[model samples]
Target: MRRDLASNIADVPAIAPAVQSAAADGAAIDTKGFSSLAFLVNTGAIVGSGDFGVKLQESDSSGSGFTDVAADQVDTTAPATLTATSSYKLGYRGNKRFVRLALAKTGGTSIALGAIAVLGHPDHAPVA
Candidate 1:
């Protein structure tokens, strides 16, 4: 059995952890060498009341031209309306080569939130 997960999977910084009040558009992640992806959204000490909607955007190219991924391609539908200090895991089953996180903060104070994209099922082991 292989126990070295660090060498077998690749990770990309989807969003930087920080206290933000406005909507955030996370960095784009390329999914070319991977087949599976899971997104982790973390929040700490929300100050106001509003739905911090979370959604996935995709594009053939990582630089520009992005659109919202189909709802069916994502695992969760109601995880968008989050307003507390918690963490959520979202799975992406879409076929898009590039994906990113778009956070919509509606009428909320500065919320500390961050996100990461965990790549799995790489085409080759020991992802680099």
Candidate 2:
């Protein structure tokens, strides 16, 4: 995890619940969190299970909200195999501090996410 003092100071008291969702082939996930900061997505798969891909999006509005941030197509051809983890850092250069983070499965028949972690501080410390 990296650090940015300016953004960290702005993220304090602004950290909200991180969200997650999955799709069979074209499903979508949605949730809210602090804006203009970076976030990481930790994902993996189970033994004998199928592989999956993820698509990330964020929004400043509540209703009809969300804009595409990053999208990844994961190949889970071999279960029980150690697949490389997927990660993304979101950065926005606007004043809007409130935004929603959404994840959607763009590919694969079945997929699962271990956890969605948000790091960095709205002050000076990093999220642990």
Candidate 3:
């Protein structure tokens, strides 16, 4: 059922602090009860010789085990490269209990970037 936008304001789901990419790859995120998620990524500090890639990942287990979710990612034509400051959005709806963003960088020491994910549960009913 479609809900009125105003009524859902208080229940709006959001990820805590925006996720920032580190110098190296990080671990998976836990999404036990959320049925949906939207990730927003902002990139910066890219040099001509640096490259970066971000992919949406999911896993049934809550641990480090994770695999890429087919077809759900940013940069459709070419893998994400930090040629300039840019913003990208990606969404996921799956049966897995855990989800996360995977970051990969090459030819550079770092790529300045941050991401935030908003999660939703269809069964979440708002209080009157």
- Model 2, residue 8: what's the lDDT? 44
Show how many residue pairs clash in every candidate, following the order shown. Answer: 0, 4, 0
> Which ranges of candidate 2 are over 4 A from the true structure?
1-21, 24-36, 46-51, 70-95, 115-128
- Which stretch of 10 consecutive residues in model 2 shows the poorest summed lDDT? 24-33
lDDT of residue 120 for candidate 1: 90
Q: lDDT score, residue 20, model 1? A: 76
lDDT tens digits, residues 58-97, model 3? Answer: 7888676688787844323324564447777677766677
Q: List candidate 3 stretches off by more than 4 Å.
A: 1-27, 72-79, 125-128
C-alpha lDDT values of all predictions? 0.83, 0.36, 0.57
Global fold similarity of model 1 (TM-score): 0.90
Candidate ordering by lDDT (highest first): 1, 3, 2
Which model scores highest in lDDT?
A: 1
Per-residue CA lDDT of model 1 for 1-128, tens digit only, reads: 24599877788888899887788789888898888988898887777665577888999998999999898898863365775788887788888899998888777677788889999988888776
Best-to-worst order by TM-score is 1, 3, 2
Candidate 3: 10-residue stretch with minimal lDDT: 8-17
Model 2 Cα shift for residue 43 (angstroms): 1.3
The TM-score values for the models, in the order shown, are 0.90, 0.41, 0.66
RMSD in angstroms between candidate 1 and the native structure over all alpha carbons: 1.8
